[model samples]
Target: MEITDLTPAERRVWEAFPRGDGVDFREHPEDSSVDGAGWGPERTVRAEVLRALLLGAGRAEEGRVAGLKIKGARIVGSLDLRYAVVDHAIRLRDCWFERKPLMYGAQLKALVLGYSTLPGLTAATVRVDVVLRLSCCRITGPVRLQGAKLSALFLQGAVIGPTAGEESDEPPLQLNHVEVGTDIIANDLTVHGQLRLNGATVGGQVSLDRARLLAPGGIALHAETLTVGTDLRAHRMEAHGMVNLTGSRIPGQLNFAYAVFVNPDGVALRASSCAIGEMWLRNCPPVQGLVNLRRSQFDLLHVPAATWPEKIRIDGLSYRTLAPHLPAQERLPALEREESGYLPYAYEQLAGAYRTAGDEAAARTVQLAKLRRHRRTLPRHGRAWGLLQDVTVGYGFRPLRAAGWLLALLLVGSVAYGLHAPRPLKAGEAPDFNAVFYTIDLMLPIIGFGQESAYAPAGWYQWLSYLLIVTGWVLATTTAAGVSRSLQRQ
Candidate 1:
């Protein structure tokens, strides 16, 4: 087939493709206005001509290392290359497209549409040998790349969303089940709809640093079961809706430092059952809604103090270590915010972490707080028993309180027995009527010091002896129980 009848603009690109050279049609950068509004046909290139050049249509005389690189052209018509095998790299910079570039199931070296304006993209299942970049491009519709394989996918500083008054039922950026070799760097990406990354697997990192997801009161970023070999950094990213990462496995760190997730009506972050290594939720504002970390496991969890939101679901959430190594007092408040009601496992998990850190005192504090929270849901009699245990034994967390109770009881008995004298049963035969010894004998159950047997208390003093005996038995039982618990914990 003879390659003739090419327009002056098309001829320039055709001539440059053989030498892997590029053709620039614009007088200045972005010389073609957005959407190619008011652009003349002189700077236009048909998609068919560009596609023909990319498919090895160039003459054999002009030859080696051929690629297609064009800039600042108004591309008319759909650039469809579905299922075609193109062996050249195609890069169109600062260009305007009349329609979405279609590359579904196509095999290519690279497809870079940097700083271009297009409706959207449909490159699902396409395999790109090198990077597939749409950096700083303004896309007006959804971009789907489900099950695609790429070395890298860079959408840095891109604005991908629907046009004004366009209904956003579908996600604007879809990378479902994508297998990327290196990374998906989308820093400073602005999307007006959800960014779906369901089941995507990345070999390296996935950075959404400073990205703005503006889907308010909806699912902003849904990445369920996403597997990242390394870190998933979303530092300072802003999401006006929920960021759901349920069941995702990020072996490397999931760093969300300074990121703001706002979804007041529902869950702000639903990261249930995720297997994460070191999650940093540091130095951010209070999450607007419930943060669901249910059944999730983390190697390390880093959070700032007093920034916990009012609602949380942390049942079955386990972490090995906490950064900043805060005491139980600082971290216990987060457990209290569980919206689904108090879970003893949450407290136990916290207490165990403190114990692992060799902070027995902090562990006891956490256990004490757990008892208090548990006591609220008890029956009337159960609550009364709990109150007695708390006041006298500090729920086994404060064993010193039990000693204090014993001292107070002993003081009361001593004062009562000192003021009153009990007549001796045997005249001049019994030991001397020592008030302290007799009081000790009366209060201590099953331990006779011979003073009680020698003396006979008449009138109200006898009744006081009985009262002291009962009080002593109760105190001894409670103290024994509390001490047994303390020993077991040790």
Candidate 2:
């Protein structure tokens, strides 16, 4: 479009473009002469004229619109670029917009809106070949990017909040189902509402380091079903509500080290069913609520035992390895910190995981730890029974304890019968009894050697006979149970 044919607002934008030189606006003078005509802050443009200028520039060579920069201008209306394909990069710095720009289904090379102020942005299904930057900008309403595709999204140091006079609670930034070729860096961002990225697929990392999100009593970050090819780094993130990443798949690590979560009565972090390569929550700020990791799988876990929240739900959660090699004393206590006393199956699962990783010593430690915690839950008198099971049979893991008791009992009985021999009851009964044979009869409950009927016991011997009978029954029952348990485990 020729300058003469353009509208007054369009003419101003046309005049703002540099002639042939590829100098960026950042290097240009604040009050540089435009098209031999001097322009100032008073040069406001309508959104329609800006759109037309972009369309005209798209038809030109790639660098023809390289320095097509706009600054200190107030856009009068919504800049609707729906379905428009622009080839060159667009940069709008220090600009103000009356309403949010609508870029639904639009295609662009790159978009930069640094130090700009807008009510919001709606770029649903829009595609950007290069970076989509909103650095140091102020967004007042929801920045919706549902189904959009971009190389990277940079919102570093941006301030996002609710629109003026709006009190309804909703997400301030939504990237639902969006696909990014690279990272989404939002470090130092101050978000007043929830930042929802549900179903988004990121080829690279999603870094929200040092970001502060505020959505009290609700979800501060919701990334359910998100697929991240690399790490989700949110180190030092301060969330006022739950940070939910339920069912997400992260091929790389999920790092949340030193992050602060403040949802005292509810779930502070929920990653149920997630599959993360590794997880780092070591030295995290005190979480006031529960951190639920039910059914999640991680290759490695780095969490301090003392830093565990007041409540945690780890039912079915398994990690292939644990960092720093927490001893059973520390590990079991952490698992016991759950509000619901103790979960025996959780301990079993962890021990099984350890065994699968070729850490049998750790597995046995965990198994014994589970037994100890379980003993605490039993009644005072029942705890003694449990202790006996542990010491004698190792909670059915050591069947040889029953055999040891039986052998010891047989020895004691042999010595007692040898010390005081019994006499035959009938005159015709020839005494064919020895100390060992007589003791065997008393020790084996199901078998008989005719010793108890044929030979008569004295006062002390009679009591000893009764003691041996009771010991035989106890050992036999325990041994049977232990053997059955070992078989079942196999």
Candidate 3:
């Protein structure tokens, strides 16, 4: 590890470090042996020595490292003690890198570590400058950069591996309270590990906020107490495992808004103890997820004047899309006045789950409650009451004409009975014995005596007049009652 016994190539790498101040990394083609292949056991020491020397020279103009490579030597021995000062942003593009506890506690400027594979590299407590872009990097061991200050940290298209085993002492990627600058766009990044940002404070907008974590994958992003400035836009970020952020504080709107989670049977976003300015999980299409904002508060009153998606899938519930601005009177009326109460379906599902587990009383209570609400919210006087009345009036009251027909029939019957009178008597024939007997017999029956009528009684036409009067009143009363009830039903 001494400088006196340095080989020719090692000597050149060492000499360049001290002499290459303010050097442009792009100009030095020999700075990074990006295409360097396998290294021999004997040559690795020389190569590593040169690597350390290059790092010691510190950064050139734009924080670029010159001749940075290891060319695969099994990574049994420690390498690269000198923390390469990246004057320009460091680029590890196309480097056949193999790190084993190397760069363990190094300080450097912003890193553009991408298109490279570093298996066991550990940057435990390194303080990085603005913008740590790690696109398409395959990281195996736990990359713990706790207390690292990353301004525009992006990890787009990177593949991160998980911890070794249960007893493995590797800490999760702890960027705990690491302050980020403007945007943290990490789209299409896959982390097969426990990505923890327990208390990270991103000063600006945080945008992981599309990274995917496959399952039975271990712990996903746990930004529990992370703080954000503006929007946390994580749209369509799929995680088969859990993404627990129970106590995160988002000052602006949390826009997972439309992010779809795969397995919501697990904890999706547990913001139970978090504080959000506004929440926009409006139309997420998760098959089964739980956005447990149980005790969270939404202080941001103005949740963008845009129309929100009505329906969402939560814990096996498929909520149909609805207008967020629906008037209280307009939304499908639920018995509960509180908006939270509108989640009866979800409640029922939970209750059913409980009930299926042998909690009979609880299950019955939930089902009964739903039934009561359904009945309570039913519209008054049936659905088509008003329409039926309108149609009745539009048809010109044919009901009234039907009543007239019944009345006319009764009047005709009375007229026919009178016209078929039993007697047609001569004007002066009363002195005849036979005629007198017949007239007295008819008179007895008409006067209520128990005898057959041989002739009709006097004033029978007057009786018909009275029948007409009664029929008129009956028809009028019935028509009035039907019309009154129809109008009053409104």
TM-scores of all models?
Answer: 0.96, 0.78, 0.54
Once superposed on the true structure, which residue ranges of model 3 sit more than 4 Å away at CA?
Answer: 1-12, 15-47, 54-77, 80-90, 101-105, 162-172, 215-218, 299-490
lDDT of 1 at 175: 94
lDDT of each: 0.87, 0.79, 0.51
Clashing pairs in 2: none
Full-model lDDT, candidate 3: 0.51
Candidate maximizing TM-score = 1
Kindly report which residue pairs in candidate 1 clash with one another. Answer: none
**Candidate 1: segments with Cα more than 4 A from true spot:** 1-3, 30-35, 59-63
Error of 3 at 87 (Å): 7.4
lDDT of 1 at 95: 90
lDDT of 2 by residue, 284-310 (tens): 866888999988999888887776787
Displacement of residue 59 (Cα, Å) in model 2 is: 7.1
Regions of candidate 2 where Cα sits further than 4 Å from its true position: 1-13, 16-49, 57-67, 71-77, 163-168, 334-344, 368-388, 398-457, 476-480, 483-490
Per-residue lDDT over 407-456 for candidate 3, one digit per residue giving the tens place of the 0 to 100 score: 45444643544455433344343232233233223322223222223233
